[model samples]
Target: MDTRFLGIPELVEVPSVAVVVDVMRAFTVAAWAFAQGAEKIVLAESLDEALALKARHTRWMALKDGPPAPGFDAVNSPGLLRSVDLGGRTVVQKTTAGTVGALAVKDASLVLCAGFVVAEATARLLRRRAGDQVTFVVTGEDGRADEDLACAQYIARRTTESGTDAAAYLRRARESRAAAELAQGVRQGAHPDDVALCLEVDRFPFAMVATLEDPLMVLRPYAVDSLAD
Candidate 1:
């Protein structure tokens, strides 16, 4: 299997499989939503698209670019998703890096969203589909964010290396500047528990795969066993 790691600024050539990593919050939040029983998640490329979708479907939850708006069920925080009951519901998510990166590589044979939460599951999924060229797109915020790069590297290692020190990688991610900024957000009115939630590696056992359903891009979890079959 040929696996390559590309940053956001780099053009993504369509590969057999493409995994987008946004560990700081976006993809992490999606993984938590699925873990919490969310029926599906629609990733929007922009906040306007998310708002438009929410306008047409009142039952859908919309997360904008900034803090959680009044009357919105949740924002981009994984910590806040824990309090939300997303059973049989769809979440429309728009973020700076994650969604943009996902949309950019939508043409890939398979597009998956990843974070520390589902890192192992994602790697296992890739291993199951061995012999296919894989690309890891690190969707950093503006420039290279340590958390996203670390998550991408972790996934790459897991895919190529037989044994990986997941704990060590998680420790590095926690001490990263991006992670520190997220933790500092607690003092700035960000969800106080979000930083911890994002840091919890391998929390979920499913990889979130994105599929095109008409005009929307839907993200749903796929178990490692199912993929092996």
Candidate 2:
């Protein structure tokens, strides 16, 4: 199996198995949403698109930024989403990195939105499908992405090898500039728990994959051992 990592905005050649990662917040929130029993997540290009889709669908919810401001149902913070009961609801999520990176690879044969919360599980599924070349799309664009690159490396090691130091990878990510900004966001009225919540490794035990169905890039979760070999 061959694997390479690239930043989202810099992506040129997309392979069959594309692992799009947004470890700081977006994909982390996606994992949490699935953990909360969200039925499916629709990746939208912008806030307008996300809200429009939500407005059109009676059972759909938009998880965009602004912390539940004007048009959005929920913010992009997992700390706030953890308290909301999303059972049987379809979520429309639009984020600067993760979801955008996901929809960018809409034509890829396989797209997996990943984070540390489901690192091992995502790698396991990738390992099972290692017959093809893989690309890790780090969505923290323009090199402001220590956490995402770290998560990608950890997943690559786990997918090809036997052991991984989840704690070490998390620690590497904690020292990044993004981590500091998120910590500061917590102080400035942002969700207080996310600084620690986003850092937690393997918090969820499933992998989130994006598929084109009914023409929407729908993200759904699969247990680590659920997919047939």
Candidate 3:
């Protein structure tokens, strides 16, 4: 099967199966929650809806993102998720880019969330769902991104050639090399902790997909530990 890459602007031409990434934060936290034993995740783009869902379901924990507008349960931070016990529970999460990308790809045949933390499983899922073309729609911070481009490059290279050299690409992307030029000219900066959190390669064994509930697309999380092997 052939592989192709697309930025956010080119999402419409994306194939049936798509991998949506917000690695610097959102999907990383989702991976962490899965590691902590969360059963399912419902992604709500708005805080009000997420809060309402959390209120209705006692087992759900809400993850809020973007700026701190006050009164949110928590902002987009992997550190905050460490304090919760998600075993047998559900999570209602919201992020600037992650949930939005999930919503955007609602029409795709299959759309799964991915991060550096869950790259291996994500890759396996992508291969299983491979089609004439594979798209990686990266959700960037504040309408632009630097980290997700590197992530797109990682997926494109791996899907095209098999296996990504994380350390090599990280160095090149970090140094702003020619092939790694996408890493430059970013107007946003993720938390230092977020950078560290999102950099882990395949630390978790789960993949999340979107399910519809009217206008909202809820994330349905599942364990894909077998894919890791």
Candidate 4:
């Protein structure tokens, strides 16, 4: 398998398998959403698209840019999903990096939205599909965020070798400037629990995969055991 890492959404292109990384929060939030019983997540390229999807599906949850709206269940924070009952509900998500990168690689043979939470499972999934060329797209903040780059590298390493230290990678990510900003947000009383939650590596056993279902890009989780070679 040929595995390569690329930074930013502009460099993202169709590949045999595209692993979109947004470790600071986006894909972490997505993994939590699935763990909380969310039926499916729809990736929206823009806040306007999320709003339109919300308008069309009254019962679905919409997460747009900025703070949590009154009617929305949560923002882009993974901590917020802890108390949400997402059973049988569809979530529409829009973020600055993760979702944008996901939408950008629409032509990929397989698209996986990844973070520390599903790092091993994502690697396992790629391992099972041997010979597939994988592109790790880091949807970094303004083109380069330490956390996302760390996650992409971690996944790449895991796919190529055994005994990858996911915890160590996460520790480095926690000390990044992007993580420091999140910690600052916590100090400012903004989703204080997110900093810890986002730093938890390999917390979930499922890998979130994206499939274009007509006009919507749907994200669903597949158990790692199911992808065994």
Number of the top-ranking candidate, with TM-score as the measure? 2
lDDT tens digits, residues 1-229, model 4?
7877786545634677899998867899889888889999999877777888888998898875457665555788777677788888899988888898888887789999999889889989988777888888888765478788888889888887858877777777888887887778742224777878887878999999999999889999989876654
Clash count for each candidate, listed in order shown: 0, 0, 0, 0
Q: Tens-digit lDDT track for model 3 on 134-206?
A: 6678677432465666776676666545656878645533433211322231312234455556677767766
lDDT of 1 by residue, 88-134 (tens): 88999888889988987888889999999898888888887788888
| Order of candidate numbers by lDDT, starting with the best | 2, 4, 1, 3
lDDT of 1 at 224: 81
User: All candidates' TM-scores?
Assistant: 0.92, 0.93, 0.79, 0.92
| Regions of candidate 4 where Cα sits further than 4 Å from its true position | 9-12, 186-189
Give the top-scoring candidate (lDDT).
Answer: 2
Kindly indicate the candidate among 3 and 4 with the higher lDDT: 4
Clashing pairs for model 1 are none
Model 2 per-residue lDDT at 225 = 69
Which ten residues in a row are the worst by lDDT in model 4?
A: 182-191
- Residue pairs with clashing backbones, model 4: none
- Model 4, clash count? 0
- Reference-based TM-score, model 4: 0.92
Candidate 1 lDDT score relative to the true structure: 0.81
Residue pairs clashing, model 3? none
Error of 2 at 17 (Å): 0.5
